[model samples]
Target: MPRKDTCKRRRIVLYAVRSAEFTTSDDRQTVYIVETDHDTYLFILFTSEVERNLYLYAREEEVSDEVKENFTNLANELSFDPEAITYLPKVPVPRRLPCLAPCDCPGDAPRVPSPPRRARPPDGLPRRPYGARSAQRQGLLFRQLFEAESFTYTYLLADPKTKEAVLIDPVLETAQRDTTLVKQLGLNLLYAVNTHCHTDHITGTGLLKQLLPGCRSVISRDSGASADILIREGHALKFGAFALEARSTPGHTDGCRTYVLNDQSMAFTGDALLIRGCGRTDFQQGSPEALYRSVREKIFTLPGDCLIYLAHDYTGQTISTMEEERTLNPRLTLPLEAFVELMNNSNLPKPKQIDFAVPANLKCGVQDVAV
Candidate 1:
């Protein structure tokens, strides 16, 4: 099994009104405490200095000034920037306080539980007839594949009637697994499509071409990458009767393209957009300014109900919707300058595979295939 972060020394505490439950004291103002791996501390969620003062104004006799001082110092040590904090709606549970929000707490902290999920299409919705005359009657055969090493998501979309299929952002290590599944499903794999030239993991397009003859590779022409087919803005990549409308969204990389299904039911946003985050613009011709525009204009313009599929998700999320992302994406929701500052200052660790992945991915990840 792939190793995942189980627990990272994080906890939550809520200060409630004297009348509310979960209060630690009986004095009109009460204190809440949380325990972590290292020590016990008073925890409160605050966005600005003003809010911090509100949290600090506990009943002085009940909670000592010394304890409040320590809390203030800890919050400062964590560099509580207003831009970094994301506030969530307070959920109303029976006895426990609903999760409030998450912050950039010290250490590999666990995230606070999110509010109850919104309604979505049912998982077992019966597939429509393959060749039905009505556009609404056609069903898409979709599969989401994962490569644990790089935390990448590979999507396989196909037409149920013709079995014509496309694989998006496939990784080199899992080429055989994808090939086996395609064969098992009797799919005629038509295209191995890449949304952009990746840095973290080598592309599986080349291997797929070799494994499944006649399968061509696809990428954005601006990506400066070699491929069997180069697509551009407004291009349509058709397989069977359905097509993917290519929209240039180049903030993550010069070549990033978001592929929307013809009917606008779904969009494959490469590294450009993520579950509650977005692609890093620290390298690979990354421009926070350009990415902000791309998302706000090209992606946000889609229908609110359009389903969003992404290239990678670290948090085990498989899908999201336009309405959810437009409203909830922490990074993108920021104003342009704030978004730029946040992206530029994210001191993320370098990807482990960049050195080899970039060179091979430029050639459609073909160089890594065993001859």
Candidate 2:
């Protein structure tokens, strides 16, 4: 296409309220407003000189009374200069996506093993079933419920049609409870992910793979740990209902990973980005500088409205917004130079029994607990 035609595209972000279009190129995002559907274009002018020039030229021809009034009001109120481009290029679209796996019993199979079921109390309590669905399907949601044992939190995510789901970083001590939860929910156990193999967590995931057939185990590449599926910074998986994009965050562990779910302003920051600060950097292969870049570049750069759910928060806080973390986190608020100093200086205690706990975590959940 000719430069003139490409320039003619006149990228306009239609409305300022309830919607916004930020044209991004070369890793830089610019926020702008498009007031009209027609081809008329205007760039925000910060300086008085540019403002006058825009006003004079925009009203060069005989303009309608309403348009003239709008031009005057907008021009006067405009404070920041926004770049104008004609014929903004269309965003690249994702290609044909595959389906999610479901837990449908085979038709010819004899008495479908009535999987273990969770019995809810008849008492008048609202049964809240946590639902997860694959990005492939927009409206379909798979619902499940499991009591988070000790400090563990249960998460359900699946591909669109396969309706398959995976449990991430669950507690081991309560294996039967979670299995019952999965069976009651009618979800097939495809794979379980231990974001970073940690002992206090992941015991159940290992146990489930054996108790439930075909459920593979996955972990990060840098983690230096083994798994059925070894994923790294660039790996992605399509579960039956949802697809997850893996992000390598080194501070928590050399292999600590974060998963962005459904682009719905929600990311499962295994332990990298927590509500207050990121995971502690004193652990194996943990580096403060690497953690800083992970949060600043990979996590914080996203929309402020995105939701971040941390895996372990002994304090009982469930969730937090990216905006809050950006503004208030002590580690994030400080300069990177200062952060590195703190990561080195802070006198935080070591995780309670990692040496004994971690070796067992690598086993997926069947191994017995150490005294």
Candidate 3:
């Protein structure tokens, strides 16, 4: 399969020709059929202007034998064909809905369309046998690391092409483990970025810099922590061809920032938002009002399909979607006033590590790096 970014630009173009017509056009256009739980989509790849013009002018055909056979087998298995094609299942064209496009092929075949529709699974067959990483995330190397002592999550994101990477919210005790993993993976660690200074645990950004030469520590300027790089909203931390766009979300801490990938497919939301709950706004300049707005405005505004990766997950849950959190978050669903009241009234005890952790994190977790 092609890279995820490449596939996103592909369009489903229907042509009247079949196996016999595969020889008509040049090698500039190729057809692909994708099957998902919701629907089946036909994709067209036009490599040159001449091929696109030919396809638009007369809807000529050209498909490799391997692809042609695959399409035929898939169509037969799914009971799909030109005449039976319908527009009910449409692939969203960005945000707009394109119902159909005119088909200029020889026969009276149905026009091409896209959408999201429910399709029943075959008898005794599961829609998806297991959960797996999406093909759309193909070119990106993403790892979710955990520190059991603090129940914290550290993220390692890298561009597979260049092996340039950044670690998000590394814990002090686990810094060596993370560093070893990076070296074993042959990656060039570029940045150890903290979303904010933490009260429960020290940040490994400072230790990571010591362990991995050339690695810089990044933190929001508002965090008031000592770091090699201080960033603000709209700052882009890049590694090779990819970048993490920072969005300041300062309710949990004055320095909390959410790092969203350039493609908007995933986000590293540290303490700002969680699977179903949110961070406590009881200390470190924490404010319910600011948090509510931060989550609703900064985090919720991302695409619904964007996956939410958190800095910490107390429960076993590790991931969520923007849509799920927007609709299902218990505290966020309430009116602003009610939400604020609930948060302000909670008398949760101070974290056990606050005294030492806060001071250590303020310096980016270097002095206590003995472990």
Candidate 4:
């Protein structure tokens, strides 16, 4: 007739909490007793917890309410008291020795983690699981975006069809996760393509070349600093029925390229067009006039419904459409006359490495940085 305090069942096992709380946008007072758990797990109780749960829910099979109901009904039939909650198994498990504090050891702190090793995926970049494309579609495959050698958003795009895949931009942290997922998905490397000459993003092209011996490398015209297949503007890369076209949008950088997956209505603008804005033009042989014309004359001219896929999101917002950007991006909407005037009057500070980076990026990011 009675039930145990199932209220104690917390989604997370945190050590402690005063209570749980949820807030409506602009309304922070509607706090509630979200489940409580152990202390170490408190980190999972923040707003980030919801994001983590959403990610996990996408990856794992969800527990259905039917199964839960059946389990409860069986327990009730067995006359199990729901009012009492007991967790102690009363069985001894192998105990692990606690690590002593390093006060007695000076060398402990010196053991810094070594740099992430390079990923050699035959010859291409590795892709990971990126969740659903839309509300009604299943997650075709996984995608992992990483900061590659040149600080590029290296991507691993998988083909759920043949379980074969390609890597877009694999930075060096990408190797660990890429190899793990590739093996997990039983996929093979097909090709590695660079949207264009990348400077800020880490370049894993070299690393991928080393790992994947036979994978083909696709680079926009004169992309690979050393050497590779030149992807001229409007080149169509066909994969079975799937194809991607290289749309040259030269303004942010001379060789900046955007790859459009026409079937998907999405164009991956490496650094040309971001989610809500455009990349800064203070770096790498940048000319504000050139950037203005590129965004106005080239990218903005695309179908208003074109979905823009950004490589960087410093502002946190993800993918958006050209229509949204047209209505929202101030930089893109500025009149030509005003744009030139603004640039002339703009006193924007130079990029961190303007002293040495600008010239380097123009040369396809072959910079000689002295560390």
Model 1, range 134-213, lDDT digits (tens) per residue?
22343678888899998888988888899999899999899999999999989999999999999989899988899999
**What TM-score would each prediction reach against the true structure?**
0.64, 0.61, 0.67, 0.55
lDDT against the true structure, per candidate, is 0.70, 0.57, 0.70, 0.48
Model 2, residue 182: C-alpha shift (Å): 1.1
For candidate 2, lDDT tens digit of each residue in 297-342? 8888655555577777767687676667988898888899999998
lDDT of 1 at 328: 95
Clashes of each: 0, 28, 6, 41
Indicate whether candidate 1 or candidate 2 has the larger TM-score: 1
Stretches of candidate 2 off by over 4 Å are: 1-150, 159-161, 364-371
The TM-score of candidate 4 is 0.55
Best of the two (2, 3) by lDDT: 3
Q: lDDT of model 2 at residue 232?
A: 78
User: What TM-score quantifies how close candidate 1 is to the native fold?
Assistant: 0.64
The local distance difference test score of model 1 is 0.70
| C-alpha root-mean-square deviation, candidate 4 | 20.4
Q: Output the lDDT of residue 185, model 1.
A: 87
Worst 10 residues of 4 by lDDT: 49-58
> If the candidates were sorted by their lDDT against the true structure, best first, what order would they fall in?
1, 3, 2, 4
lDDT of 4 at 262: 40
CA lDDT of 71 in candidate 4?
31
